[model samples]
Target: MASNAQRRDVTRERILKAAARLLSEEGPSAVTTRRVAHEAGLQPPALYRLFQDKDDLLDATAEHVFAGHLANKLTTAPSDDPVEDLRAGWNLQIGFGLANPYVFGLLLDPARARDTPGQAKGLLILAERVHRIAAAGRLRVSEERAINLIHSAGIGTVHTLLALPPERSDPHLADAAFEAIARAVLTDEPAAPAQDPAAVIASFRSLLPDLPNLTEAEAALLDEWLQR
Candidate 1:
């Protein structure tokens, strides 16, 4: 017989997988513990033992999808140009967003984003990249403004893509729009070099003292996205 820990692990995996499948098939409202258990071939109580509620399962599923997306972006290819790296990262993000629109939709939802740890990690990643750019002294605009603009554009792309009518859901059009936005934010001219994520974040941090108007949840959401 499986030990309690093993059973717990199995249940967790089952719930997450079920949530992801349902999230992809149905929308967010379709994800419930009972539905997940039915999908996983487990009793409803088994799911409750593993996750507190639907929100818990949704969070785990989002993290699982995000980790998969990040794994595809590890690059060994180095360029002396910082803008090139920034372009790579931006394009990668857009590609992932379009590829996993359902999971991406979860991240964009402000209500579901409360109490998420991934939010902070996303900011760290962005800060790391910004720091890299600052070290190269290639920033054409204030780092904070630049980071905010790029970050907002990247996020806005997801919303824009989601808003498109089914008939107009063209991935090629999405990719082209993404490239134009990335070019405008990350480079002063075409063929400019890639920047480091770290330097860009640090420079932005130095300019902003505090998020004055942002509510806790709003601030949390921003940090979560930036960390990623």
Candidate 2:
């Protein structure tokens, strides 16, 4: 016989799968506790035992959808250039949101996103991508600022597109928003000449030890000069 915990797990998975199917097929209105429970072959009371309420169940369902999107994102082979990697990530995010409007709507809600593990994971991935651009000396702003700008633009783009009827949606909106944000946050080139002086100095300071023909003491002195 299955343990109580094992049975609970099985029931929870069934509820989630059934709810997800309902959400995709008939949108959010069809995911009522009674409907989901019926679809899962469980009693309605089982849903109450598993989830705090309808909102909780919906959040769980959204997390499930986001997990699949994130998995696919992770499998994408990263590009050699950090800027290219950032662009790829942005495209992936926008694509997922457009393709899964119901789930994306729940995931993007500021009220629902707090404390959501799946949403947090998505933000962390974006942060990592921004950090890579900063390390490459291509970021024009602080990493936090870059992340905020990019995330805001992406979310806005998705919401805008989703608000429009499919036939009326502008195909170029996502790319335009991406390019505008990229121009604001990133240097035109990867090299340092266009970078902020402080960022350039900091980047060069990091490379001090690898400088050819520089003694340790000389490199230390150069580092001090760069810091000044």
Candidate 3:
């Protein structure tokens, strides 16, 4: 027999699955306590035991649906080329959003994003990718700026594609958008030449903490000079 904790886990999974179905098929407004309980074969009061309220239930449902996508993202091994790896991640992100627009919208909603743990994890993954590029002396911008640009561009690409009438949709928009962001944030060549010394400085700044024999204040001052 299932233990009490095991039974609760099973019950939670059933509720989340039902809620996710309603969200995907009928949208957020349809995921009420009554409807979800019916769909999950439980009474309305059962959900209260597992979740605080309707909003809490909705947040958990979103997290449940995104779990698989996040796992897939985690499985991508880093390649020899960081640029190629980033582009792969970008393509995967766009594909995931296009394939799961309902989940994407729920995750994107600022109001509903009140309890988003997945987004934070995804940002950490992106930061690691950007850090790799900076360490390679290929990024001409700060890591924060580069991460923001890539993240914004991806979100915009998904929104653009989804907003289009099917006949007007251009599949190449994602590739073009990524290339534009790349051009804005990355140098034409690695360890950018004298004409673009910022990339080199950015590269050094990435290793600031690893440099030997530098006091905290001295490192901070050097970083300020490098940013200039």
Q: 76-118, model 2: which lDDT tens digit per residue? A: 8768798889988999999988888999888777777666777
Task: Give candidates' CA RMSD values in order.
Answer: 8.9, 5.3, 2.0
Q: What is the TM-score of each candidate against the true structure?
A: 0.68, 0.82, 0.90
Deviating ranges (above 4 Å) for candidate 2: 110-113, 193-195, 198-228
Sorted by lDDT (best first), the order is 3, 2, 1
Task: Please provide, for model 3 over 68-139, each residue's C-alpha lDDT reduced to its tens digit, 9 standing for 90 to 100.
Answer: 777889997899899989999999999998987888988888776664678888898899999899999999
Please, what are the lDDT tens digits per residue for candidate 1 over residues 1-228?
Answer: 999899888778877888888888887788888888899998999877777888878878888777666555544354677666776777778777877887887777777766455645555555556555655545544466667777787888777877899898866764676567555444443223345454354344343336588777876776556545
Model 1 off-target regions past 4 Å? 1-7, 75-79, 166-228
RMSD of 1: 8.9
Candidate 3 TM-score, true structure as reference? 0.90
**Window of ten residues with lowest summed lDDT in model 3:** 187-196
